[model samples]
Target chain A: MSANWRLNVAVLYPELLNLYGDRGNARALERRCQARGIDAEITPVVIGDHWSPDDTDIILVGGGQDREQRRVQSDLHRRGAALRDYIEDDGVVLAVCGGFQLFGQHYRGWDGEIMEGIAIFDAVAAHPGPSIQRCVGNVVAIWEGETVVGFENHGGRTYLNEGQQAFASVVSGFGNNGGDGLEGARRRNAFGTYLHGAVLPKNPRLADRLIALALQRRYGSDAPALSPLDDRAALRAHAEALRAAFSPAESAIGRRFA
Target chain B: MRSLGSGGTALPGLVVERLHDGAAGALAGQLSATALITGTNGKTTSAAMLARILRADDRAVIHNRSGSNLMRGVTASLVEAASLLGTLPRRTTAVFEADEAALSAIAAAAPPSVAVFTNLMRDQLDRYGEIETIARRWTEALGGFPGDATLALNIDDPLIASLESQWSGSSVRYGIEDPDVPPAPEGEIMDAVWDPETQDEFRYTRRYFAQLGRWHTDAGARRPVPQVAADQIDNAEQGVSFTLRFPAGERTLSLPAEGLYSVYNALAAAAAATALGVPPDTICSALESHQAAFGRQEDLLVNQRRVRVLLGKNPSGLNQALRTLQAPGERHHLLILLNDGVADGVDVSWIWDVDWESQAPHCRSVVVGGDRAADMALRLEYAGFPAPRAEVTRDTGEALSRALSGVPEHEQLVILPTYTAMLEVRQRFGRMGASRLWDVA
Candidate 1:
């Protein structure tokens, strides 16, 4: 990237899709980029707002409640074409929990109402019924040899299509669905996960990887090599989260998922 | 009940319920009157305030003072207060705080003559599902109450005020009417901002922390005028003083509890008391003399240093506690505890939503403790607290000692803990010769 290269981060439907401190992921990306001398601009794209994918380097969509998801469904559909084109061009996108479900093919809510997704990842999420317990508690997963830890609370059971890649293998806690050991979905530069300890603040590697990918997409072969900063606190938090996931009490709770 | 041993808050009630199918309803029916307090936050303190008001009015009040707010806890309190023949004394009044999720069941069992609804915020999604689900449950619960039962609702909270539409009973609407109070910062988690009917974003004319404010939408939805409103709120390090306005008259109440949230609790309790026909002087005096519920801004003295325990279970509550810490002029010594136990909502992600960035720099020394202590420390680190200044000690007792020792002689140490962590701290204090958890008023 050029010396004065700047990254524009578009946070989609922040008023509607913000929950469980998921905006921390956007903060993590911006802070980490700024620490490396990259000027990262975060713009919140609410219901009445629009953003051009050509000008935005990274896009973040957080989780929300069922009502909020319903409110944002139409707005997301309106912007679905541009988001799909951005993903196809290797643009970096991180969608979490409810946002993850909305980025898939479609989500069937508890009342059986279907909400169309952007289909960036060929997946479908369905709520079995209100009678079924939500998939909740600490989660530990392995993503490309790195152990990622977070908390997952969702009623929707997501299933990736045949050609879609699983984001990570769940080591503990329910992920995606209790029936499957896999968690999240990844296609090209687009990633989606049910994890929300704001996920990226603890898992710095995943955050930096997204930043690096955004830089590469913005500047191609001339992209500057990403600089590494001290991640002691983040790594310590990551270790603690992993320990919490495997603790005796949490593990017993995890057995309920079985 | 005390003879049953440690952690017996809910067990005795469970046994009584199993013995008699309608034990709760039967016991509550024996009382002269009963008031039920339910909300996401401020249940314990509000109930305590109302109970004190009733006591000041020369009425015998039985309350679940230990903050065991579940259905079983309500039953336990009733059983403990009943005579050997399973009957309550003459003119005995009951004030019980019900868990937000268990309100319907508790209300049905107790059959309250008055109900108090505090503001609702995003809390324990892993346990409560979503804010809307709980709101729906509360609306259905209100339908089951007798038409004569009065509701003391916080009108500032759009969600709680909206509950009035489903109930036919008279309501005493209370809210903060102080326009000078700081507006809610951008990006704060507003759990109830959208108009459910119109799906239009409600515009706030005056916003406070979280979603408590005077709001209106272009489509004509608006907050109702509160009959009991608070204005000229003066928040100090010692306590909060506010002018409590009601239908009869207005009085200035100075509560020993810290934070504007405590003022809300006082307003809620005052509204309930007013509905129950308590005199304004009695309510004001009772509230002013009201002691903080255990771990809800309760204080302790260890050695020569003062230790204040502030309970912070969710994002909004924690933010308010942090704001309270900022009120004191001097830099503070902090012991922050984050637990993931069942009561603490296993998901620790809510910490990130707290406005720690604004408060971290004001602390002189920081020690994090609990099952998820490292997570709290990391949060402080990200919030720009110097790495070397934050010490992580997972044990609550050890962390308290370290934090207290860090404070200079006669200085105050502030401890912010989640539900289970607060219990752990209280247990340690109990062992150190402080009053036992149940012995406190």
Candidate 2:
């Protein structure tokens, strides 16, 4: 692919899935790509709208609530074929929280309500019994040898099927669930995790990795060399978030910056 | 019923709950009448507006006036209003603004005569689940409420408007009917766009920053019900003027609160007040004299600097505040505080969803302070706010000092803070012995 090729990105269900500022992941990807001198265009695929990954290189799906999740559940089933095709074609997909759950095999609520997932990743997202507590707070995950810190507020206890790789090991915060101490799932070119909000801003390395992967997939692994910008401020923010995520006292107080 | 100590708000309720968890709802159930105002935002402003109108109509009422909307807060207010004998006086009305999550407990304990459903927005994601989850819970709570209760609904928000028919109650729907913006709410994060009936997305024809929609009631599957509506909003510097349309008649009035959202709040208050038999003139005059709730567009003099405090808890509220600030006038200094406390919804990422680019143009200088001060500064810088950049202080007081020192006396300084941040900031200014919000009757 030419260096000037504008990367076509599809932000699936952006209007509905942008829970807890999960849209920041899209922003981080866009800004990072632009700063690296790569032209990128984002098209939002709202409900009832039609779009395909014909030439799209990256698809981002953020988190949503259970009701919203259910609303999109059937729609996801209809596009199950297209979703599987996109992942099979080596397209990079990033799904957060509810989005992550939907890209899996299926999600089962404690109430026996079953939401069918697209099966982009081999996993099952389940909720604890109705009265069980929710998993919420700033989180730090060990990803690619870097401490990827972000905020996670979700209730899904996603379990990866055997032979599937985990995105990031749980360092702090309830990962996929409190039991496994693991978070997110990675298979092929698709990625799913519970971290929202600061996932991109707090972890520039991971953001760059996603972008780089998209570039490599589109440009036959010979993507243009990327440039780096000063991330001192971003790193400071990440450091503080990581510290806060580990400290129960600080986490309880808030996403502490001081 | 009296200030026994320098105790914090909700302290009494917290203590009573330890002794007895059900004391609050039990005490509230005996009131002559009850009205609950609830949603993601504007509960206090709308509830206070309705409560004031009720008072003007000469109705004996005691409301949860301190902006405490939780179950415990409800219990405390009811406990306070009740006598030592555990019974309220005759003809006493209780109007309370309930937190979204607390609505179920309150509804089960003491079903209201009228419940005003305000527009829901993405707020405190770290605390509350998604907007859809909150909506589902709200629907569940309404199911548990008295069957014949009246629902005051915001039709502009497709989500809330859709609930009118789902509730087995008489409904009064209200919405912004401005010519420029549609009567229904439509924009990013609008949950009502996907029409369930059509099995397709409902594309709004009008341009709306977030407000759009028509007024209609759906009783059940394919069954339409009659409902009242509001529209033709004209926003002015002082506040907003709009025409309120009811089944019997329609009336036009100007509210003293700023922005179209505040106008929506007035309409919500009007709907609830009308259900309680308030005269149109009484509602109008009461609203004209009403003030925005504490830390919500409230004006205060802090350390000799005149400042306006506005609550910026969620993306929608912050967007509206920013839109209002984009007035075709002079630029303003800004002091923004962002906290992720439990009440504030610790998932600090929602700040990213806010349209800070539009806000950057209206801000001449900025001082960001709070638990997430650095994050705010980072966003501002990314939005391309010119340098000699925003002053970042983790300490709220130090942040206020920096902001005051930068602005001249004549200029307006807007301090936008999240929930817990607003509480602490107000406490700082309140300690100076200025007027207090609860001091009002």
Candidate 3:
């Protein structure tokens, strides 16, 4: 076990990319580390700010509204090479919803305008427009043989390229797009998904996985195994989210005739 | 119109619209000038303030002060004021609060002479997608507004303030200028902050709730455009005395409303009233007489105990509500209702954005209710509230009953609920004979 090691998470574009409590995922990662007695610090990567891979272990970004997404997409373009460099050097990255779309090739906007991305993954997302329903609900997925439960709310239909891998299989809700049966994208230590009950507080396992990956990238093989923490409440919350994900009943008012 | 009985705030409008197509516009045209207040958080309060002032000036106001801010709601209020052939009441002015989602349609169909823009905050993400979507949509819609129309805006919100350039009509911008407020304290989670002025990345000198960073334009100057601002504010627990400053002059007035957000609403209403040419003295008096809309810091008695209902439909609103409930050393009997009704925004995940931890310690006993009650209870548990102490249920009536059961007479119970849930909770209070207006609440 490594005697002393600290993990620094660079939450990219937190101010603009926050949607559906995605910031909670960052908090989840922090709490998991605290529960395990691992040293960790979360630094927000707001607009016009830069992060160093040397001090950063994990890069996390969440979803945002379309216009904000475009803004973040532009800022991300400025840091494209730095992000790629961070990933190339083995820094762990986590992106969700709009962030997931932006981390890929690019996203087609609701207006049919093209909003470019950093293309960290060989993928692209397109909003099918307001005519089609936004995939929004509690959704469960099977990831690395465990159930991953969270919430999904997005209009963009993300399609992975030939070589990209899916992060998980949709167990209940819409995955990427409703037709794909797949959710998010994965490659090495970088992960992206639509599961945002902030994705971590309920799916503590994924939070631990990200934390462990950050630790491994920092401490290498000497990283100690994280002690199991009590997650009964989180699991219950996950169960509730899974139940909600399975139910597609729309509110009487929000429902649109599909 | 007086025979709605209860919960029928929007029915008359719907009936009128059904009987006469384009009734919203036809009826609006008959008034001296119509005004529509729209935004995420302060719609009801702002609409109430404006309506009260207009009515105070002997300008009969046709308004929906019952918290129904939809097209049907506004149309119903107008319907009640108009004749069978659609002639509006003489000297009557239409003052309505339009929902953010319904604003574009409302503006396009019946462009009010005075359209006020209250600050936009993250609200009902499931219902609105993102607040920017509504902002962009409003900008496009307003670009086509009648040239005679006047837009009153909140320059404090970067998103709403950014839309000033879109309006070809006359406009007034309003905001809070107190350094003491410190911009409401940024919540645990934030999603928007970029310098609208310089187009440079924005950094907050002091963060506030929802990262409603000091609004700046692309050039990096706060209030770059002239705006009607609250020049000086002296705040208190239950009310505030503020000096309102506009291009014309400054008038100090007091409102019984609580929170900096309520003050922003007052500023917005004041700006709108001034734009409509209502005298400053009249505006001040109306504000003094203004009562907060139901469920907006509304205190009522139920089952012989005092209760306060604070409406919270989204993350920022809920966070602000919780923040207001937190007294340094005081505890509370809290009934939190989370519904996924369309009005409530089905994406319950936004609850995670709320700083429940800050309010957890202040809860003596929590009763979590509504459609998403279980999820809310789980959130409270995760927020560090003792799991065993909180009573959780989906039945609003049962939950409120449980919450109010053992409370002593001295302790006031607090009820915080989402939009639809607020309606349902109020209905339950009505059924239980706990509402002040037992038959109509």
Candidate 4:
């Protein structure tokens, strides 16, 4: 990338969808870029704020409570077209948990309330009610030969459309619908997942991948190859998370869900 | 029993709960009055404070002092307090700090005459689901209480204050009314920021921390005036002093605890004490001399160096602890223990929500420890602390030694540990002849 190339990231509804330390994902993105000598700027897009897709290279949306989801539902719908346009232009988007659910076609709550989504990803999430166990625990997934580890805690069982692709296949812990052995949905450069150990600080590879994608979209052929930093802490955390995901004691919750 | 990995604090209660479902209720019924304290944060400190005030009033109190606040823990404490004939003293009062998620079941079993609701914040989402859900459960549970039962509520929290309208019992509402307190910083994790019914963002007139504040919405909703309020909160290195106003009278109390959050705990306790007819002098004196609960600002001397153990289980609690550290403005040596144990919520994601960045510059040195030490180190590294400055040691005991060794002779070492990690620290201290394990009541 050009020496002056900078990445602009827009965080959507941070006031409403900032649950589970999801904002950590944005921080991870910013820090990783700065570590590689790239300038990254994050702008929060809250209610009543106007954001331009032309100035945004990446977008992040985190999870939230059900009421917060409802509170942001209408506002997200208003920004849906612009977000869809940005995605079509190959912009990088990482939507986690509630954000992931809202990136799909629609989400049907257990109480029979349906919240419309932007339809950028061909997926739908449904809550099976409080009677059914929530899909929660340490999760290890395989994404394009990379091992991604995180913590998944959500009550919604998401299913992708017939021709859509999953972001990763679950190695352990319940993901997506829990029965599908799949976690998250992916379309083009847009990604959605329930993994929220901030999902990026531990999975530096995934974070770097997202950053590289955003850089490529902004700088095209002149996009610079990213440099590597000391990831010892990240690697150790990843290993620990992976071990916890496979440990019988920690996996007991997964067993109960099964 | 230790080989089974159980602390033995809640095991007997679990056995009792399994054997006879109504045994806990029976034991609780024997007490003259029972008070159940529940919230996302401050339960232990608040309960301890209230227990002290009750004791100052010469009332015999049975309490779950082990920081195990589950129904099983409550049952266990009651069981231990009962005589072999399965009876408590005629004038005995029970004070139990209950886990927020388990409050419904515990309240159903114990039927407390006084229920204390501390402020609700985002806590242990992996275990408690959400703040709204817990608030809903608490409201529904309080509905099941007797009409004559009294409630001690925090009016600063819109969610907690809203609960009073749905209950039939009288309430003593408590809050901090100090306008001098600074507004909460941007990017701090906040719960109850928006009205669920109106969808309008709640505007804060004065915010202490998280969602504890005097607030109003555009739709005409406003925070209820607290019957018991504190003002002019002075957070000193030794403790916090505040002017407390209540129905009976007002007094300046110098509580032996740190942080504005501790002041909230004191207010909640005083409110509960007021509900129980404890005199103002007795409450102030008890609070001034109150010893903190174990791992909640519990201090000790280890290897000739002063050490303070602060338990931080969630984002809000951790934020408050970090805020306390920043208040002194002097460089601090910190040992932060991050565990993903079941008791610590299994998910360490909440660490990201804590405003560690604000305290990063204030840390002279930091040692990260616990099962998730690497994660905590990574968080600190991202918070602008030099990566090389933070030493990651997975073993809590080894980390404590390293941290203590680095502290100068006159300086103090502060340890911030999660729930299970705090227990581990206490055990290490206990082995080192620094302090006893679970000795605070």
Model 2, stretches more than 4 Å misplaced? A1-5, A46-51, A70-89, A113-116, A220-222, A250-258, B1-7, B20-30, B82-90, B182-187, B195-212, B215-231, B246-250, B387-393, B432-441
Give candidate 4 misplaced runs (Cα > 4 Å). A255-258, B1-7, B388-394, B436-441
Give the candidates in order of lDDT, highest first. 1, 4, 3, 2
Q: What are the interface RMSDs of all the models?
A: 0.9, 1.6, 1.9, 0.8
Question: For residues B173-201, could you state the per-residue lDDT of candidate 2 as single tens digits?
Answer: 77655556533233344545454444445
Candidate 2 fraction of reference contacts recovered: 0.60
* Each model's Cα RMSD: 2.6, 4.2, 3.8, 2.9
Ranking by TM-score: 1, 4, 3, 2
Name the runs in model 3 displaced over 4 angstroms.
Answer: A1-6, A47-50, A70-91, A110-119, A129-132, A214-223, A251-258, B1-5, B186-192, B195-214, B217-221, B224-228, B245-250, B386-388, B435-441
Question: Per-residue lDDT of A19-58 in model 3, one digit per residue for the tens?
Answer: 7777788878877787777777889887677555567898
Q: What is the C-alpha lDDT profile of model 2 across A31-123, one tens digit per residue? A: 888887788898888767777777888898988767678877777787789879888888888899899999998999988888889888899
* TM-score per candidate: 0.96, 0.89, 0.89, 0.96
**Candidate 1 off by > 4 Å:** A255-258, B1-8, B388-393, B435-441
How many backbone clashes can be found in candidate 1?
2
Q: What is the DockQ (computed on Cα atoms) for candidate 2? A: 0.57
RMSD of 3: 3.8
- What TM-score should be assigned to candidate 1? 0.96
lDDT of 3 by residue, B336-431 (tens): 888876667767888887888888798887777777776777678768875534445457777887888858875788889888777777677666
Candidate 3 shows a clash count of 17
